[model samples]
Target: MVPYIRAQNVNLTFRPKNRDPVTALQGLSLEVGRGEFLSLVGPSGCGKSTFLNVLLGLLRPDQGEIHLDGKKISGPGYERAMVFQEFGLLPWRTVLANVELGMELKGVPASIRRERASELINLVGLTGFEHHYPHELSGGMKQRVGLARALATDPEVLLMDEPFAALDAQTRDLMQAELLQIWDRTKKTVIFVTHSIEEAAYLSDRVVVVTSRPGRAKKLIDIKLPRPRDYEMRLTPEFNDIKATIWNSLKDELISRGIGDGR
Candidate 1:
C-alpha cells in the first residue's frame, strides 16, 4: 500500500534580501505508514519544524511535494492537526473551552462540541481542571491541554513540533508515556519532531535522522521495543543502544555544522 504520508525530493530555502539564502531542507524524501509513529531528529538547522509546517501546508516546498493518504497536501485541512511547543493556549479560555476551540471553528454545534471537549479533557487527564484557565495550570498540564485540543478534531495525522520541549524532565517522561497510551487508543498517524534521542526512541516506531543545513534523510532506524511502554523500558540496554545510535548520527551532524568541537 502507498505510504500514508510521503515527501519526495523536497527542498526549502529561506532568503533574506540582505544576506545569502540558507537552505533548510534539500532533496529530503520520507514515508510514514498509516497509524505509524515517526520521529525526526537532527541538529538545530535540519528543518524538522519546516517539514512539519510543509505537511501542515503552512509552507510550500520549492521542489517536490508532500502527500497524505496518497494525495498531495496543498493546504491545511482539519484532517491534519498540529501541537506547537509553546502550548498555544488562550490564557482567558478554560481548559474545556480551549479543547473545544477546533470543533467550535469547524461549526460544530454547542451540544456536540461540549461533549467531545469533555471527553478529550478527561482523556488527557484534565477532567477536574476543565474549568481552570491556562494561567492556573502547570506547564505539563498546559501541554496536556494542547494535546487534547489537537485530538479534539479527531485528525488523521498528528504533527507535533517538540511538544514536550518546554516541560521538566520528569514531566516530559510522563507525557511521553501518556502520549503512547493515547496513540494506542486512537491509532492515528503521528509525525513527531524532537531534539532528544531518548524521547524519540521511547516514543516512535521508527526514527528519522537528518543531516545539517539543507537537511536530507540521513538514516531511518526501526525501534523494536514492545508496546504499552513506560519509564522502566527507558533503562533497558536496548533502549540505550537505540539512543546511542541516534546520538552518534546526531553528533556527526552537529560536528559537520561546525557547532561542536571535535574535542
Candidate 2:
C-alpha cells in the first residue's frame, strides 16, 4: 500500500530582499506508513517545524511535492489535527468548550459536539475539570486540554510539534504513556517532533533524524520495543540502548553544527 504521507525531493527557500536566500530544507523526503507513530528529531532550527507547516499547507515549498494517503496535498483539512507546544486553548473557554472548538468550527451539531467533547475530556483525564477554564488549571492540566481538543476531531493524522516540551519531567513521562494509549486506541497516523531521544524512542515506531539547518534525512531508526509500554519500560536496558543510539547520532550532528562542545 502507498504510504499515508509522503514528501518527495522537497526544498524550501526563504528570501528576504537584499539578503541571501535561506534554505530551510534541502532535498528532504520521507514517507509515513498508515497508523505508524513517526518521530522527527533534529537540532534546533533544522526545519522540523517548517516541514510540519508544509504538511499543514501553511507554507509553500520551492520544489517537490507532499501527499497524504497517495494524493497531493494542497491545504490543511480537518482530517489533520495539530497540538502545539504552548497549549493553544482559549483562556475564556471552559475545558469542555475548548475541546468542542474544532467541532464547532466544522458545524457539528450542538448536542453531538457536546457529547464528543465530554468523552474526550474524560479520555484525557480531565473529566471533573470540564467546567474549569485554562487559567484555573495547572500546566499539565492545560496540556491535557490541548490534547483533548486535538483528538476531538478524530483526525486521521495527528501532527504534534513538541507538545510536551513545556511540561515538567514527571508530567512529560506521564503524558507520553497517555499518548501511546490514545494512539493504540485510535490507531491514528502520528508525526511527533521532539528533541528528546528517550521520548522519541519510547513513543514512536520509527524515528527520523535530520541534519542541522538546511535539514535533510540523516537516518531513520526503527524502534522495536513492544506496546502496552509504561514507566517500567524506561527502566529496561533495551530502552536505554535505543536512547543511546539516538543520542550518538544526534551528537555527531550537533558537533558538526559547533554546538556539541559538551558544555
Candidate 3:
C-alpha cells in the first residue's frame, strides 16, 4: 500500500546570527502508512521535532520532497494538524472558542463550526469544560483541548511533538492512555515525536529510531501487538522486550553525543 505520508532524501539546515550553520536533519527519510501510528525518537537536538515540522509543512526542508496521500506537499494544509508540547492554545479563548478557531480559519460557517467543535470537544472528553479558559484547565486538560482543536479540522494526519513531555509522570501516563484511546476512535494517521522508549513502544505501530544530530534513520522497529492497548499490556514481557531492544540500539548514539544514559 502506498504510504499516506512520505519524505524522501530530506535535508534541513539553519544559520543563526553570528553562529555557524546548524544541520538539523541530514538526508532523513520516512514514510507513514495510512491509519498508521508512527513514532520518531532520538536524543536531544537530534532533529526529531524538525522532522515533524517538515511533515506538517510548517518548515521547508532545504532539500528533499514530501508527499501527502501521493500529492506533493508545498505548504501547510488542512489534511495535517499539529499538537505541540506547549499546547499552543490561545489563553484568552475558552475551550469551545479555541477548538472552533480552526474551522473559522477554514471559512466553515459559524453554526457548523460550533457543531463540529462541540462534537470534537465531547470526543476528547472535554464536553462539560468547553466554556473554561486555558488558564483554568490542568496541563492534561489543556493538551486535550489542543488535541480537540487539531481533530476539529478532520485532519488525515496528526503530528504530535512531545506533547506529554511537560506533564507530571502520573499525568503523562494518563495522557498517553487517553491518546491511544483517541487514536483508536479517530483512526487518523499519526506521527509522534518522543524521547521515551517506553512511550513509543506502547503507542506506535512502528517506531523510527534516529541517529544523533544531523539525524538519519537508524532503525525501524515494528510493533505487532494488538490494539486497544492499555496498562495491562504494558506489563507483559513483549512490551519490556521491545523497550530493551530500543534502549540497546539507541544507547550508543546517545552516549556518543555526551548525553550517555540520558543523564
Best by TM-score: 3
The TM-scores, one per candidate, come to 0.96, 0.95, 0.97
Off by over 4 Å in 2: 16-20, 261-263
Per-residue lDDT of model 1, residues 88-195, tens digit only: 999989999999999999999999999999999989998899999999999999999999999999999999999999999999988998999999999999999998
Which has the better TM-score: candidate 2, or candidate 3?
3
Evaluate all candidate structures by whole-model CA lDDT and list the values in order.
0.92, 0.91, 0.91
Residue-pair clashes per candidate = 0, 0, 0
Worst 10 residues of 2 by lDDT: 254-263
Quote the positional error of residue 73 for candidate 2 in Å: 1.4
How are the candidates ranked when ordered by lDDT, highest leading?
A: 1, 3, 2
- Please say which candidate is ahead in TM-score: 1 or 2: 1
Candidate 2 per-residue lDDT, tens place, 1-263, comes to 78788999899998989999889999999999999999999998899988988887888999999999878878878888888888989998999999999999999999999999999999999989999999999888998999899899889999998999999999998899899999999999999999888899999999999999899888999999988888899899999999888888888889989888642
Compose the digit string of candidate 3's lDDT tens values, residues 1-263.
77777899899998889999999999998888999999988898999998888888889999999989899888889999999989999999999999998898999999999999999999888889989999999999999999999999999999999999988999899989999998988899999999889999999999988999999899999998888898889899999999988888888889989989663
User: On lDDT, who's better, 2 or 3?
Assistant: 3
Native-referenced Cα lDDT, model 3:
0.91
Off by over 4 Å in 3: none
